[model samples]
Target chain A: MKRPFQNLVYLYILAGLSLTIFLVHCGLKALTVTVPAQAQVDERVTFVMHSGAEPRIEEPGTYTTQLLAGIMVPKSWNAREQAVLTYTSPKGNGTLRMIPDSEIEPVSGVSWHQAAKNMFGIGPNLVDDFEWIIYRSTQSYTFSNNEDIDFNVQVACNVGSENMLVRLGFYVGSSIENLRPEDDQYKKFTFSDVFEVSGGEGDVQDFVNPQLGTIQPVRSLDNDIITLVFNGGVMNTVLDGLNEVYLRAQAFDSDGQLIAEVMEQNDKTKMGSIGGRQFRIDIWPRGFFAIEKGKQIARLEYFFTNADGTKTVGYGNTEEPFRYTFRCE
Target chain B: MKIKQLLLFAFVAFGYLFHASCEDEMANVVTDEPVKNITGSWKVVQLTRNGEDLSQRLNLTDFRIDFKEDGSYILANELPFVLVGSGAYTLNDPQYPFSVLMTADGESEQIAVKLQYPVVNGKRQLSLSFSLGCAGNTYQYNFEREN
Candidate 1:
C-alpha cells in the first residue's frame, strides 16, 4: 500500500519514461521515412529529319529512328570489291570477310583455303559451309512474319594464337512504316548502325537487326489487342486500360555500332484513363525496335481480367504515327 | 449520483450529434425542375437563318411529343421525314442556366434554351431558339411559348 503522495510521484516518473520512449520512437521513424526528392523527367522525343550521310548525332535533340533495310553484302575476291579484311593485332595478323552468299558460286574452281587467302589476305583454319543472305527492303514493304536477318562472317588468326578475331560489322537500314496523309508530325529518316564481331568464329547467321522499333503493348484490354493502323506501316499491338506497356525502337550506324532508339519515357502519359476508371500503371514501348519512314504506328487494343472478376473491357481512340516535314535549323 | 450524471452526459451528447447530422443534410444543393405547364406539344411557327427566312418550313401538322417524369418520352411524326422515336433523357449538368441532353433512337443531342424568369402564379414559360443553316446561308428561329 503506497501513500497518495508516493503514488503521485510514481505516476510522474512513468510519464517521464513514456515521454522519453515516445521521442526516441519518433526519431527512429524520422530516420526511416524517405520523402522522394524532385526529379527531372526527360522530354518526349519525336522523329525529325536532317542532312549528312554518315550516322551523326545532332545536338541535344530528339529524332525518330527506324530500321530501313537488311542488306547482305556477299563476299567477293575479284579485286573489284573486297569483303575479306586483314588486321594485324598485337597477337598476330589475321583475316576475315563479310559472309559470302552461298547462292553465288565460290570463285570458280578455287579451294576453300585459296578462297580464304583471296578474301581475307590470310588462310582460315576452317571454312564454314554456311552462306550469307542479306535481307533488304524499304519502308514501303511490310513483313508478314518474323523472318531471320541472316549473315555468315568467317574469321581466322595465327596458328594456336588466342587473340585472333573476325570483326564483321553489319550496317542495316529499316524504313519507318505507316504514315497517314492527314498527320504531318514527323519526317521519316532511315538510320543505320555498325554491329561488330571478332575471332575464329564459324558462320554467324540469322542476325536480327536490333536497331528497329517494335510495337509491343505493355498491357492489352481483354488480352485482345487493339489493331492500330499506321497509314503506310504495319499494326503491331494496341493500348488498353490498366497497362504498363513497353515498346522498343533501335537504330545502327555504318560501322555496325548499334544506336539504340528508346522511348525517353519523359513524353509518355505515365497513366491514362478511358471509359471512366482509374488504373495503376506506367506505359512504354517494348518489342523489336523496328520502324520505317511513311509508316503509321497503330495500337491493337485488347484486355485481360481476373478469373472471377468483372468482365475486362476497353474502348478509345488511338493516335497513329504520322509523317511531317522536319528540318534541322 | 454517478448514474444520474452519466445519464445527463449521454443525453446531451446524443442531442448534439442529432443536430449536427441534420445540419449536414441541409447543405446539399437542389436544382430547379422543368415547369409543369411547359409539358405540352408546340408547333414550329417559322424557320429563319441569318435574319433571312428559309423556304422549307417545318411541316409540323403531324408532329407531336409527350414528356413525362415516369421515364417516358414520345416523338411520333412516323413518316420518312420523322420516324416515331422515344427514349429517356438525363440532365447532364443542372447548374447551367437552361440546357437539356436528349437521347432518342440510340442517338443523343444537346439542346440549349432560354427561360423566362419568375414563375407567375405557379406557371413558368420558356423559348426555343434554333440556329438554321442551308446552301451557305444561316438564320435563327424564335419559337414563343405555345400556352
Candidate 2:
C-alpha cells in the first residue's frame, strides 16, 4: 500500500511539471473572434478572427510557411465565392485565398480543407448545415531561426437572405503540422456568441443550441428525395415514449395553397424506428404529393403523431408544425 | 464417232461448270460481337434521395434488381421504380449505353431512365436516375454487382 501511494505521488508531480513545460513552450498566445451582433440580409459583414501566435519551431532554420484559417458558417451564405480573406501582421500582409476542395496537403495526404474539418468538426454546433470554409495566405512568409511573428485574419462575407441566429466558429493553425494541439488551446478552435442576421425572410434557424429535428441538404428542389427526422427523445413532447410514430406533412404550392398536398397519417407516411425513439421518413417530394402541371412544393409543415391520429407533436412540443423552406442559394 | 465426241464435250463442259461453281463459294467470315455484360444480381449499396444519403439511415440491403442474361429483369422492390413488376429490358445503345428501356408486362409504353455504368472500387456499379412520381425530383440509385 505504501509503495502504491508513493507511485501516485510521483505521478501527480510529473503531471504538474509536464503541464508547466508545455505552457512555457506554448506557441499560441491568445485568440479572439468578433462577429456582428446583428446584420441585415444581403449585407456584407466583416468577421474577425484575431490571434497572437508565435512560431513553435524549435531548432528553427529559415523556413517558408503560410497561416491556415477556417470559419464554420451557415451553408446558405455561399461564402466560397462571396467571401474574401486578408491578413495583417508586423511581418507582412496580403490577400488570403480559399484552398480549393480536394487540393492535397502533403503532410496529411488529404485536402487541406478536409484536414481542418476532420480536426475540428462543427465546433459545438448542433446542426450539420454548417460548412468549414478554409483559406490560406497567398503570400508565404520566411522566418529566420531567431525571428518571431504574430498575426490575425479578417473576412468580408455576404450574409444570406434568411434571418437566423448563427453560431459562427473560427479556427487558426499552420501548414507545419495539420494535426492536434501540442499545447492546450493552440488557438485551434473557438466560436462566436450568437451572431444575428436579421431583416431576412423565413424561419429563424438556431445554430447555438440543439434542435429536435433539422433537415439535411437544407436547400433542395421538389424533385429531390427529402428525409424528415424527429427526435422524440430529445425533449418532452406529447408523442414521447411512443414506439410507433407517423408523419403528418402538408406540402404547399408557391401560392401557399394546400395543392397537391396531403396532411394525413397512414402506413405510407409511417415513420420508421431509428432506435432511441427517433423516427425518420425518406420520401421523394414529387412522388409523395399529387401535384398537377406547373405545381411544385415550395415549403413543408409537418408533425409527428401516434397511432389513431392522436397525440401529435410539433415544434417545441407545441401545436404549430416545424416548417422548412426549400431553395438553392 | 460424232455422237461420242458431242457426248464427251457435254460431259467436259458440265465438269468445268461444277468446278467454277465450287470456286465461286466464299467462306462465311464469323466475327464475335462485343457484348456489354452487366448480367447479374445487383444490390443497392447506396441510395441518394435528392443528394441526401439514405444508405446508413435506412435498411436498403434487401433492395435489388436482377438483370438476367436473357435480356429480362426482375425488380425485387416496390421502390419508386419507373417500371413495375417483371420487365423486358434493353440498352438504348449496346456498345455505348445512354439509357435503359424497360417494358413492363404487355405495356405498349416503355419506361426509360438515364444510366451510368461506372467501375467503383474495382466493382461494376449500375447507377440509374429517374423520377417515379413528379418529374422534378430525381433519385440516384447506385447498385453494385452482387457476388
Candidate 3:
C-alpha cells in the first residue's frame, strides 16, 4: 500500500506540473510585445493603398493644362474682335472666335479639333473620344435645364447729397398659372396685391400682408433673383460720397412664410474707393428663384435719406421706377 | 522514492530556467535606451490627404519648418502667411512604429502623431501620419530633414 501511495503521489505531481506549464505559456502570450528595434523603420513604407493606378502629374502644354490656362485669362482680352483666329483643316475651315470668354466657337463646318488647336494651341489628339463625349454631355445638360428663366432689373441712382442713404424694396404679387401680361385677370391687381418679393438686401422687417393679415416679416416669393446696378458700374463716386447706405430685400412664399432676406450696409469710410474717391453701389443678386411655371408681377420701391433726417422716397407708381411683370414657362 | 524526488527536482529546475529566459527575451525586446532628439528644419516632400495626393494645394515648394532647440517651431513659406507654433516633441520609441506628441504654445490640446524614419535612395526620410479631426480620414506627410 505504501508503494502504491508513492506512485499516486508521482502522478499527482506530474499533472500539477503540466497545468503550471500551460498557464505560464498562455500568460507569456497575453503579455504586450514591442517590435524589434532593427526592423522598425523602412524606407518603402506604404501608408495608403489607392484604388487605382497613380494619376499622372500634369505636364506643361498638355490639353488639360492649356485649357485651364485659357480659362484663367482675363475675359476682356478675349472680348476684342482682334482675338479671333482663323483655322483650316482637311475637313473644313472656319473662324475660331474666343468671344464670350472661356468658350471657343467654330463657324459652320470647322471641326472642334481645328478650333481648339488654333485657339489654345492644344493638339487634336490630346483629348480622347471618351473625354470629348463627357464634355459635350455636360454642356448639353447645362444648356437644356437653363432656359429663359432670368428676370433682370437695372436701376440708376443719383445721390445729390453726400449725407444721404438709399434704400430699395421689391414686392411680388399673387401667383398666376401663366406669367403672360395679356391675361385679363392681371389688370385687376394693385399695389395692395403685392405681398412677396424675389430678392433684396436686408433682414425682412414687419410688413402687413393685405390678404394674410399682418405677417411679422416677409420672405422671398420665388427663386427669382433681383439685382440693382448703379450707373451701369460696380463702383461710382456718387454712391461712395453717401454717409450711409442701407440695402435690404425680403421674399415670402405662397403660404405667407418668409423665405429669403438679404441685407447690406456701407458706411462713409467703407464707401470710399481705392483712390479715396466715392464709388457707386452695385447690387448683384447671386441666387436663383424657385418659381414654378407661372406668371408674376413685381413692384419696386426706392428711398433716399439725408443726414439731417430729411428723406426722398419713390414707389412702384413713381415715374420710371424699377419694376417688371414676367412669365416663367 | 529517490527517483520520484529527482524527477520533481528536475521539473522545478526546468520551469525556473524557462521563466528566466522569457524575462531576458522581453528585456531585449524593449530596451531602456534614451529616445532620440530631432531638432532641425524639415521640408515637406510629399503630402497625402485621405489617400489622395494634395501636395500642390499650397504653393509651398520652398516651405519649411524650423525647429529650434528651445522647443519652438516656425513655419516659413513663400505663401502670404507664416505660422508659428511652439511645442515640445519626443521620439520615445526608435523602432518601427514611433510615437510623437506636439503641443502648440498657448494651447492645451496635444497632437498625437506616428512617424517612421526610413532611408530611401541613401537619404534619411521622416514620414508622419496623423488625423485632422476628420472621421476615418488621415493625412500622411513625408518630410526630408533640411538641417
Error of 2 at A267 (Å): 4.3
Residues A1-329 of candidate 2 have per-residue lDDT tens digits of 47878999999997787656544664555668888799999899998888866543434335566777888888778888798888899988888888887688665577766666666677766665777877888877776544556677898999888888878878876655455534354546788888888886666777766677666556666655667888876788878777888888888878898766556778788888888878888776766785554677888888888887878888878888888877765
Quality of model 2 by C-alpha lDDT: 0.75
* Candidate 2: residue pairs that collide: A223-B136, A223-B137, A223-B138
DockQ score for model 1, please? 0.01
DockQ, prediction 2? 0.07
Q: Kindly report the TM-score of the first chain in candidate 1.
A: 0.15
Report the lDDT tens digits of candidate 3 across residue range A1-329.
48899999999997797655432321101111111111111111111100101112222211110000011111111213222223222223333223233443334133332332233321222111110100110011111111212111111112111111112121111111112233222111111111222133432221221111111001122222222322212232223355443333343444545454442333421221223322222221212222232422242223322233233212221222222221121
From the highest lDDT down, the ranking of the candidates is 2, 3, 1
lDDT of 1 by residue, A156-176 (tens): 111111112221212222223
**What TM-score is obtained by chain A of candidate 2?**
0.77
Residue-wise C-alpha lDDT for candidate 3, range B1-147, written one tens digit per residue: 798899999999999999999999988895666545556888888776434464654334876766677766676644211123455654555443486666666767766677777787887777777653222335577778887
**Candidate 1's C-alpha lDDT?**
0.29
- Candidate 2 local Cα displacement, residue B6, angstroms: 97
Which has the better DockQ: candidate 1, or candidate 2?
A: 2
TM-score on alpha carbons, each prediction: 0.19, 0.68, 0.25
